[model samples]
Target: MGRKLALLIATYAYEDEGLRQLTAPGHDAVALAEVLRDPDIAGFEVTILVNEPLHRVGAVLGEFFHDCRHDDLTLLYFTGHGLKDDEGRLHLATADTRRTNLAFTSLSAEQIDRAMSGCMSRQQVLILDCCYSGAFPAGWLAKGDADVHTLERFQGRGRTVLTASDATQYSFEGDHVSGSAARSVFTRHLVHGLREGTADLDDDGNITLDELYVYVHDKVVDEMPQQRPKRQDNVEGRIVIARNVNWAPPVHLGEEPTARASAPEQMPLLQVTPLSVPTPVPLVAGRMRWVFRTGGCVRSVPAVVDGVVYVGSDDGALYAIDATTGEERWRRMLNAEGVVRSTPIVNGAVVFTTADRSLYAVDARTGALRWERLLGSQTTLTVGIVGSLVYVGASNGVYAYNAEDGQERWRNVGQGMTSYQWMVLTERLVIVGNTGSHVYGLPQADSGKTWATRIPHRSVSGPSALSDDMSLLYVGNSRGELRCVGTSDGERLGEHGVTGKAIYSAPTYVSGSTESPGTIYVGNDDGHLYALEDFSYERKWRFVTGAPVRTSPAVDDATVYFGSDDGIVYGVDVTTGLERWRFSSGGPVRSSPTVMHGLVYVGSDDKGLYALQATY
Candidate 1:
């Protein structure tokens, strides 16, 4: 593994009276360095220098570059005043520097650039967070302005530079003297972005140079309007700035004392059995009971149970909101990671959620973390709970754990493939679907596979849905086809293909789902909600929308409620395929809703969680 190293320097207290002293930059260097040094976050061996003089900064630079190895990724960050001399030479000011004698008192751009260019480390990232920082890269930007094409100039190279603003603009910083939260406006967002992992555009667990710059640029422009962050990169391949904290390495349960002993000694492979799904409460629709706004995007469904609604956000917090008032009851943050897309499962007194690399079990009432089992790599997949066992599918393989105390029971490194890990479990079998185009049927008592069925033509789309009794499984593929398979032998019993577009959402089953028997609701990329009869695979009704329907539907007695990419939450009649009520959430509603006690709880990309009941 290549080594990651960083040097962070912030000179906040300057000697010049005109250069107003800054409070956020010094704090930023300390806070950011602390996170980088953590084994979980960036994991960089970091060195921080606050209010250091020019001589000290120069000495440290000499040691940092001279000791860097060829297989290392090195970062140099500065947060202080930046000025360009009359000859266009950028200079970083130190506390003892006099503005009149720039060459004698300050650190020159040539000094740092020469050192960086001569370093043995091929991947060098230089970040300037002070005023006029963007001037370093402004000379090469597209149209001599900041743009994507200009940003692309850094592609395919091993060297990159990032700046806070253009030469003509000043980087903004607020004086946060008293508040516990003190960070330079730019550094604050940068640290938060790197820590949260929400900046992973592809959700691949790694934040690339492009993704980080884009995230930071957008935030700085959005939050500080006057600032325009810029970047220049020469990275030959993807330069991973940080890994998502949620996808921690896997930990076996019996490896610790708090968990259970091990898997059962020896047992016969059990057959798949049916399980019952609870009925949804019928809501009248049209009136909002209450509305709650979170700090970030609410892209996951809200799971409502026992008067508490559980929802996860892009901010990486699992929130328990009051079902009656939409007020928060308790909240748990997922170890300073980014984005919680998995819908939480509330089993008994615990709320189970998969974020980054761990499957966290939190107290349902108090939002306290009970126990966390690491699932190797970055996994945003939802967990499956059957009886007292919790199953999670991760990048490494399939894992089973004891739910109560979080001990690993068994693990099967089946083909070692990645998964969204939306799984279905029965009393006897664990059914797993993956992007590798194979669905495996694992015996619940053992880690061996009973049968592996290949769904040729494409990968599995979203997660599979199971009938109440777990007798039949419904899975969709990237080819827009929906297949029904028998759980006992992993046999494909029937298949139906939609239009040309793929089905990104899972099939949801309602009562009477025997074969050709009960109804199944599924959303597809063709911007339609499909109502099909179970056994015969016949389309009963289809409601068309303006955009793709990647969010699963929540159905009650009379209505089908789901959101569309077109920014609408729709309530359509189940049988008639007619629009009953449509509410505009002001953003895309990809989060599936939970209907409980006549209240429909759902989340939107607009950062709002809404509860709707009948207007009458």
Candidate 2:
């Protein structure tokens, strides 16, 4: 049997003073429209209401109530301004709404409840994205001691209600590019979680309503400690709103044949056998460890190989440290004034590129400079080692140098304005993006560029993983937009904008299956660390800090680590998005964190390098 579903999206941008003046027209309405059209929920029949004429909320509600009755599953969504009257009744404001005649222009909770009273199906879901919606109130429960006595008569019903904030709280407004103003804090996380598929923690094809609620509840509280989302649920039975409908049922045929009716005969006595005892196996614990730190700010990532840790710092030096101890073995100073923002790439006995604008190859064991070359005047460099060749990006172009001699092999300069921060090398081609909003695919064998395609926006950070199949290239932009561009011709596959202030950090990929897919972690200027799944682009979880997060995230196993501008380093649960622990620092952290052995290495603007014991 086919399932029936109804979705209603309503937004009130007209009532918001800031929203009314924004140049971006239909931003909130368009966001809701996009969700409605998402392929994941194609089975749903969606109805949208936005800034309707005043004195017409009743007519709109009447139309929705009538349509919802025919659906086997119903979902009603609202996004707008809500308030409470002197009587404590919750009311949704309309476009031409006035405080004096709110009853005529706005719809109250009581009116909605009465309208939905006649719904036939047991499954009904209501999502209220408005201020003071928590005050809408559920059915009255007996007070105090009387509640215990009345519990026996209660029967579970399939009804769930989720509101944006508590009765006394107010919603916040972010930038217009973010899509909405006066949006409920809880709603932001809820929509993000749903879109990103973070609620599917087990990697199940279906996402349950309970999972969605739990993720949103925790993230909202973490981001806004004062405002709490209210949830009321009596729906115990799981309903499949959508699924892979193409599945075929197994076929079988049965006939009413003669029954064999003869076994009232003999019963055998029970026998007991003595069981042999099994030997217990002893468990062994792992013991090897390593630690390394740069004397100044260790703003660069560390590369571990051959029992040594290699890292760079703002002190303009690269250090090789013992893999098992926190002691440094040797240090080589690079002749540069700028900090090292690139990780050291190791090939054989040579360690390379520990400075921002120069490429240096040093002996892996002795820390002696083998060869040094100035790559460019301004380069957002990150090193990629492919076989014996090394790939690097600069403001001018992408360069390939022989790792054996530090000699230039070939350079691909698409344009003078292209500022490439990162590049990934494939067997046949090299993929890189620049601040000019262009991504180029260059052939490794030829000096000329293979293809160049413009990205949706300017990319300021490094490019993340290129799909194993080399089908898509994922990159994050300064505006918090994450996009997957085709590796073939740079055609846009899909894009999802992060719902934070701004994204200054690069994205990291988790290694896993496509179904249980890897995660993309990035920090935002809004002081939050977000984990988004790669397959569905659904948000897994988020951790909030007191300030912006300008550092990239580091992931090892099931834990995620990142530093924030609030001068704190956090370890979070990868699946549940819960904070396991946090370590305080002296100043703002702009450097990306590196996790190796059992320690987390990071640097702060306070001129100190920190090492914290990794606690699972």
Candidate 3:
């Protein structure tokens, strides 16, 4: 078995009276030590020193590190006060560290570095939860953010460092939500990250050092906007810091997960798939590391373009989050009008969405309002952008507006077909349907309907999908039937029924790649997600979740991902229909999952939008 050892140093009862007395360091150390020593979390050999003498700090650290074996993992954690000496060197102040003679009394960063240099352990992690902790890197100060490649460049040396504050920022003492003598802001969240599932960004049950840093950094900064944590890594492999109690190591969702294992080596971040046309490309699965949050429920799937995540909230705001750090870039709000339930679409430099019965176009980078147009009524429908036109379906009608300005281009005000699911765009036509009495095909250049078909007893449930040859269009209906019709004419091709229950949304069409055969997936109120052979409508698999799955399904290379009203997101094998994993949200999940790059973005009625990493 590999050795896992950690030394915790917390000095709140400093001998020097001139320094401010602190209440958190002592408590923070005890709390975190308990979490780390738990068999379920870190299960480390924890040696805690609280208010120890200045002379003893150096000897103890050396004794701890010097005994580490080549394959052992060693961690050193400190909390108290951090200072910069006259020489601008970083020091961790001890209980007896006097301000006047700090150089002779305090332990320096170089001293720890020296002990670490001689250690045989291949993995070492340092966490400094004091002011100016970011200065722990002796020669690495004053450098701005490192590029993505920095982690790879430092791979050979498995030293990972995280600090509570940047060199210029202060480590905060958080508000006592309940009692006094509360933990320090950084350590409180740090403990929360280690002990709670909040820090498990991927829902994979294990929290990596990098993932913990992101979760803690965002939370600390959120509570105190002035403080920013910093992290530097030379880790060649993932350094898992803790395990979540609710999750086991990921296995197929219904199968037994393997015991938590060491962090695996990773490749670099996924780059954006370049846009050759204005449609989505099939996504390849990868690990996800972070999630972004908004003020209210996010019923819409997120739009990722360039490097930003454009998403809407029922709080009446359209937000842009940094795809890398999950930091808010900017926000454009609708000001108490209504919720923005429709997913946003990113095209060129602008992003568009529907809210409060109007269509809004905002600058993608700056979040400045580019233009706004009021439809007849408030809408939960998403707007479509093709070429230079913006199409919106509302209570009054389906209206087309010029994308350059808010000018109304055309309106087919009485077709009675409206839904927010999806709209199939073709080279020369736009086909859209809804849970109304009809489905319509209209010219891209005008609002004139090319063809309209009315169902005698059934209503279209969602949007439509065009066939590979662009000859047939596929749509679902509340009648529980999957219907296919000729795209050029109004001729009915075929229709198939499923459990005699109403289909809730649009069907997804997967074109057979060299690796997969074409398949179609649709969900119904019967609580089943039916997978059918493309063109043939032959049933392939029907997965059952006791609760209805009104949400649409998104796909990665090997899995079909969707959410259930039961508040869980399920990843199932596309071929075998075996569950791969399930992530629980706080409330019902009605919004569809959006798979992009290496993440799954979805929303819950619990007022949270989640970003989950792919797990096999």
The sequence of per-residue lDDT tens digits that candidate 1 reaches over residues 120-228 is 8988888778765322333443233332222232233478888776554456666333343367677877788778876766665667778888888888888877767
Maximum-TM-score candidate: 1
lDDT of each: 0.72, 0.61, 0.71
Better of 2 and 3 by lDDT: 3
- Model 3 alpha-carbon drift over 4 Å, by segment: 1-288, 378-380, 416-423, 513-517
Tell me the TM-score of model 1. Answer: 0.53
Runs of candidate 1 with Cα error greater than 4 angstroms are 1-285, 416-421, 513-516, 614-616
Error of 3 at 207 (Å): 47
Candidate closest to the true structure, highest lDDT: 1
Point out the higher-scoring one by TM-score: 1 or 3.
1
What is the lDDT for 551 in model 1? 85
Give a tens-digit lDDT track for model 2, residues 90-207.
Answer: 6666654555555775776667776666666567777766543222224533222211111111123666777656544445444332453434456656656666656544444445
In candidate 2, stretches whose alpha carbon ends up further than 4 angstroms from where it belongs are 1-295, 336-338, 354-356, 414-416, 468-470
